[model samples]
Target: MSQSTHLPRTSLAALTLGAIGVVYGDIGTSPLYAFREALAQSAADGISRGEILGVLSLALWALILVVTLKYVLFLSRMDNNGEGGVLSLMALASRATGARWLLVLIFGATGAALFYGDAIITPALSVLSAVEGMRTIPGLEGMGEHTILITTTLVLVGLFALQPRGTASVAGLFGPVCLVWFAALAGLGLWHISRDPGVLAAFNPAWCLDFMESHGVTGLFVLGAVFLTVTGAEALIADMGHFGRQPIQLGWLVLVWPALTLNYLGQGALALHHLAVSEAHHQLMGNEDWFFLMAPDALRAPLVVLATLATIIASQAVITGAFSLSHQAIALGLLPRMTIRQTSAAQVGQIYMPAVNWGVLAGVIALVFGFRSSSSMAAAYGIAVTGTMVVTTCLSFIIAWKYWKWEPVWAALLIAPFLCLDLFFFGANILRVTEGGWVPLLVAAMVGTVIYTWLRGRRVSLERAREQGVAMADLAAALAVRPPVIVEGTAVFLTQDPEVAPSALLHNLKHNKALHRCSILLKVETVNTPWVDPAERVKLEVLDERFTRVRLRYGYMDKVDLPSDLARHPGPQGGGLLSAKGGTSFFVGRSAIRFARKPLLPRWMTVLYMFLHRNAADPTAYFAIPPNRVVELGSQIEL
Candidate 1:
């Protein structure tokens, strides 16, 4: 179990508002297309009051059960040092079990990989759905498909282009804008509900059952689309550290949930009213943009603009989330190091990853152009999210059993229903694999493959290194006896294993034939937690008079700065070791990795690992080391 922090009442409101903006963005925009798509799935059988109410009921219950009960009430409480996410939860479970459980790792990896798929699809679908609202505008009724596509592409490109500059300036506006958007949703829903109070019958769970029983196989198709209503539910738990559980829960229960509930009801009422009119006129009613049509014609265009802004905000939240997740993945050794830039000096979470940003942008563009319409894109949306939800449920069960110390049977009973719900959704979505659902599935497969290869390759590489390495104790003893030509300054050799002599240190001795007056073997260890206490950050072990092995422990979410952390250590002679006027130099080993004669990994896997390693960011930048004071010792290694 994770500890929760109590915030001052004054700050709670602000955090709650921020939660409304970021946590609710994706789900907030779901009303734009969720109902319409779900209703469309059954439109082939002809629109009926029963079908409308049934679909609306499915959507409402999904939010209540999946978002409110599962995420807000349950999973939010299962945080890792106040940080909640797939990776954080994985770290927590791993620690609780006192070992890295293979099943838990697979669950975490699958959830994370599927999240990237959602990340790419969200921007394209959200923006496209909102832009398609142009069709309902007064003079823009004839807006061409190409115009919508181009406009969405331009908006997406601009959003990504602005990432490097940072969102801090406009982030303050996100909460207020989303606040207005939710209020608008409530207002629109209420207005249409007043037209037909009877539509509120969708609140009855019976409608969901009746719809399922009546529609049979076709209902599952609609069920897949209905899953979109809770697409961003994961964000509630994912962003818990940013705003805390109380604020997010308050935001959901008090404002976001009511607004969404009312809006979906209003959409149902509007659809019912339209069906009545079509029947009265002896005309067939087809699937329409019920979300925008809820507005009076005069207000339609402005509503469209508000919706576009909301979708953009939702997209921004997903993009930034991807950046943050990538950072965590790298810290946890699930992925190779990549360039991470702090977009805001004040907010540590406001980060930009160039590779992630551009790569997602490219995928988003491809999805937009390839799918061509939100209706088509909606077919692809739910599988990744449902897959992630299934993984989350599985992980939560482990946390419940092990960390919470619940009886295994009780834990299973408590979690089994949610797992079934998730799997049911997953199975429903599986029926759409041929119809654009394969997109996210294909993306997840590729990403999961990379993560698996990186992990396996790292293990093999470490084994290979161990076989060729000299023990640090042996090296230290030999160095003391030989006393190589001593240099004037301190030298820090960074390595993964401090017990083994660092390759750079060996090369420096072999080629330069000299050793620094003070040689520190520095190793950074990423612990299975979100933050480490400052007192426990640095561990110093004296290997010999001239050599010391320093281990810097960091939580997976902690920011790493080698120089600053080293300076925190008071040396044996007093004064900061990094503060020495004698000056300090950092030695990093650069490896040219190739397949060994008897490779531990498959030939193809070795090649992929090598490619990933070769393209990883420079160690100097990653470790926050001063490039001018850094020396790279190159070596050829076969693994």
Candidate 2:
């Protein structure tokens, strides 16, 4: 038998737009409340207006340095075969440093797990902030703050309920609407800024420095605010594969960033002019009459409707992010595979995981209900976002120096400032633990421990099975003596390693020694991007008179291609005998772990891994194999 190869073509434009619509939504929506919290902390400390403007300046610089410079300009280039995410970065790192791979893997997986926390918080706060504008609604006037909170929570719940349907269907409307939403935010803010041009001074870096110095330690406490500007910015790098490098870059540079900056500036201008507004009013109509205040009284009703739509898109982005983030986690072995539901057939980009959708929905609702307002949610929001950003910055440095092959000094020079900003935000957000920041950190810690345990336990179980299983020679000798019955036609064994002979080959020969006319070791390698080439479909090798090894390479971004297509895989040796038409794929399923462990991890962590693994997507489905063609040889080992 012989091997083959192929190439996948993709559109950079479509992917970039999709990235903007999906990836940037969480961070894009942050301007809604970032300034309010910053200003609130400033006021509490008796800081002058200059100090508030200074904080805004720091946030603006953070966005530029961390997001545009670090991610868009530098980190995006480190994509692993068109796959952009923490795991891909780790994979790239491993390729660069042959021996130190573990170091990168641990950091990447930890970063990915942290992202799950960000996913949950983004929606909770974005919706609460947007819906709080209902107080400005004429007929909705005097609506209790609690009432607004409950309504927002309910709305978020309903939005999540639509997850199984997939966002692709509705996203067409989302992108255009969000485009309008950002424009409206900028327009409204500018209208107010036009009313008073003093807000233009907020752009000066001096204000940010002076403000922090003036407030002393209190300035650090407000990091929870500075952290908001770039909360979802990681998504830009994480989902870079979706749109490729150009569109996301263009979207941020031309559309997303400008709109966001204008809005932020507008908000600052509004806050300065309306110095006497109560905290409640400020929360409702911050800095530039809150973007909603821009609409004429006659248009306020429609504007409320538009703001809700924008918030919905923002929430949708987080939900989609949870899907993408979980996928990366599962691939990295940080998470067990879940029932990943393909939401859109046309757009392979659109997907839904029921477990993640519901899990995140529950988390978001809990946060909203518990905090009752975006301000409190703000405290919880920054820590995870900034922490993840810091990780991203650190990883980006590795990516730049190794993968992108940039000079060490240059990479450090470029990344150091962003790292400092991220660290500053992380330090500032530390105060939020008592207020709200503890939520994401706690979530990240719990998730990271469970993932670590499951992966570790799984490694042990595989080794145990390998040791216990019978060898191939023994099975062949047994079959020669007494021929056993064949259960499935030409049983196909899928192995992680294509070069090495499969353990199943040895186990089967020893256990039943049943000789089939044909048997194959099917190895499928999922590559980085979504599509696969037909020419590279299957690589076949004949090992012995009865044994054969077939390696199938697939891009991670590619769909789970059907093995039936194997017949069409034309190689030098006629594509081998196991062409998918007549063979049954038998997969050995391994399950493991002990619930009680006193020496290493806490007992609670062991329990969590057991629970998470139990609910993971079953091996058969996850591999995209037909149920009837699969067999689970379940086994367990000590962790």
Candidate 3:
């Protein structure tokens, strides 16, 4: 399972298609509401031709600078081995900076937490916007209008429920479906682009600068809406572990970016043409209800369905990413262990976490019912995505200077403009904190607290372990003098630290008064890098040729399978496989952690840690050990 970092042999086309399906989902759906929201935000000035052109110019530049240059061309190259994402990127940067830059580490973790906040909002906003196209359709206008929420909820229910079954088979459909979606966007945009070619002039930076000069501070605030254009850019980095770098870049540059630009420009052209027709109707026309106006009347219903599918796919991307991130968090010891299900044998990236699935579903349902409209949810969306984007850019600067060996001045020069853009959007979004922007910020704060607390709690647990536990060397020496009765079968004792005697091992010897003929003291370690080579994964030291101290090193991105990994090694003195079906037994050490009377941590933190520990997934299931052959021994530990 530690070998999960190894890219499975895949064709170029297959990888490209897969990347388009997953990596582009979020950005692909942005055209539905991002432009609409930006227009709505700036409609106070009556949606003039200059404002339409300026907004489109800002959006086009955002795609080029932020998603195109910043993410695809730059950050994609900064992957930790083949893995990318907030946490994995943090792991890589931390290794380069060592542990001294604690602030950078916290920023990285906070970015990951903020992503979950965005994750919760995407489905509700996307589906709501897509389904609201119902109001645009000719006969369907206000007919069964209340059913929109019920329909969106049902669709969400189906999406989350399908997680346990995996996405491999249907994943093929995703590529084709998205291919059609992007094509529709391009075709639709082209239809309008040809009508009013003057909107094509929005590509000129002069229009952007002129618009900014005229609208100063309010223009800066409108960037919060413009920031939505590149929200899915981070996904291109985060999902790198799933489809690798080339395919993602290939999909983005060749198809996704161009299609999105055309669609946005086309929307602008359509709006400008409408404004040209009558300035008095501009304010009424420039609204969240206007995106569907880009499409012709007859195609509106079909486009609605396509948009809904695209949004669902977009939600899938975020949900799948959350699962992957949560899995990585547990592997790296930032979170309590949660059950991870390998949903597909063919693709290692296709995994499901039920707890995450349900938690996200609950949040999505709440957001849908609470906000009730995409127009309202838009206020809550930009803050978390922009905040995470800001942190990622900051972290990338460190990676460039420290890891990539870029010169200090050169690194700062490269990242400075992008950082400024990020900060501007972040600051703009902050102004809306009272107007629903606080939702994601609140979610981010709570999640960040949990991540930091869990990390701190683990440190305390390890310190307590090192202090009270006996050394394996001393135990082996004592055993050499007076050995316990040796039984027939092999026993693999899972320990927190291989150097210290495991509580389960101590319990087994104390109560049973016997030891297996071949005993292995095993500890699985999470390293700073993204992968540990399988050949170098296991470290075995024979303690008197009968008791072996085994340490298995894995990266935060690695999949852990105790039974499968142990099967590849010998029991003692290279005799035979360590686990032999029913002949083997796996011993796990668990602690009933409680708050100490005089606590090193705050009482709130201690209680939180204890609650997480109590609800964490069992070691046997998480490590992929056969439950039938496992024994768990619990000992009380007051934190």
Candidate 4:
């Protein structure tokens, strides 16, 4: 359960409000273009009352089934130590199964990779759609497409530039601003609904079936567009650690869902009113910007400004989410370590990654220019999100059966409906691949390839190391019998396997022909949970008079501090090694990887793995070791 589950009522309310700002931002802003896009998909046969009601019904049911049921109610409860996300869920399932399952890893990687695709396209789509609302302004109806494009480009650039400085200063405003945004959505929706009560017939699911059966393939195209309504649904489960499940559920049920439903209904009602007016005048009705048009002409400008603010907030949420996900990937060894900067001293999760920020910024800019309009970009949107949803459903089934202790048959039955729904939506989106959906699929492919190569290369490298390495017990016994020239200080050797000799230690002894009077072989292991109890963090074993093996365990989300952890819990025997006359010296092995005579992997994969290894962050900086006190021993290794 989330820590917020035990909070006071006042704090609970605050968290609920926060969830509205961060968790629902993406879905909340869908009103800007979702209705217009869906209706456009089926408008080729001419605008009709039935089409509007059908699209609205599809959007409403999607929110209820996909977002409300699958994410908010079900998956939110399957968290790992109050943390939820693809990687966190992967860890939980792996621990429950008592091993690292390959299928689970692939599912986790696929979800995470698709998330990046969604991350890049969201800021571009949401901002462009919001800014494009200016066309609905009375005098701005003549606004050139170039003007809107330039303004959106500027807004996005400013948003990315502010990332390094951090959002802590302005984060307090996110909830309140979004609150006002949702209120506006409801107010506009209710006013329009009051004008045409006839559109209320959309509440019936019958219209969805009628439209699908009548339109055939065209209905599938509209179904893909309807998916925009639930594009940000993943945030509900992803942000569960930040705000407990209860608060998020309450926020969605009470405010976000109602507001979104009303907004879509309002858009439909407005379209119905236009259709009646056009028919009475003996003229044709065309698809319109019904969301902005719902507001009175006098208030249209302010509405656009508010919509823009809401979309920016949504974009900010996605950017930060990518950073958090990247951090988790590195901790789990799914990605190479990069420089991570904490934007806030009080919040460990408030981090900034320059590489991620710049890379996403570049992608967003390319998308905005390449598509040239939100309607065009919308073609590229749903595939990534739907793909992620499909992966999430599969992982949920494993968690239900293995981790929740449900019978396999029961689990299959429970998940089958949701899985089918996800696949149905995925099939709908697949129809748009040639219409720009290939963009995200290409991005996912590149990311998935990198993750696969890194994992395979690491496994092969570890196997090779173990083959050539001596056992720690043999080394300790040999050193005890033939003592080297004794040094005065203590030395710490870091390795992945504590049972084998660290390459750095052997190299140091071979070159210097001497050993530290007190030597510690240390290994750091990242566990499956989000936190480790301090008492259980360090385990010590004495191998001989001069050698002691130390193991430090950390959760995937925990911050690593080797020097501080060692100082807090010195080894046995009155801490003789740590309390040596000279301060401790840290030694790290630096491998120079190259292709083997008969490589385990293809040539291209070995090249990619070598590139990743060379560029990974330095161990001294990653582990928080003092730079001046660190020694790097280099060795050549074959893949």
Best by lDDT: 1
Ranking by lDDT: 1, 4, 3, 2
lDDT of 3 by residue, 345-418 (tens): 98877899989999989999999988888878888999999998888988899989999899989999989999
What value of lDDT does candidate 2 attain over all alpha carbons?
0.70
lDDT of each: 0.92, 0.70, 0.85, 0.91
| lDDT, candidate 1, 1-639, per-residue tens | 233457777888999999999999999999999999999999985798899999999999999999999998999999898999898888888888885589888988999999999999999999999999999999999999999999999999999999999999999999999999999999999998898999889989999999999988999999999999999999998998788889999999999999999999999999998999999998878899999999999999999999999999999999989998999999998999999998888888888899999999999999999999999999999999999999888889899999999999999999999999999999999999999999999999999999999999888877778789999999899888889999788999998888889899999999999999899999898888989988899999988778988989999888888899899879876787676567999999998888788778888898999999899999899889989999999876787
Q: Return the TM-score for each candidate structure.
A: 0.98, 0.87, 0.94, 0.98
List where candidate 3 sits over 4 angstroms from the true fold. 1-10, 98-100, 143-145, 280-288, 577-582
Q: What is the lDDT of residue 379 in candidate 2?
A: 84
Tens digits of per-residue lDDT, candidate 4, 258-316, equal 99999999999999999999899988789888899999999999999999999999999
Measured with C-alpha atoms, the lDDT of residue 37 in candidate 3 is: 86
| lDDT at 206, model 4 | 100
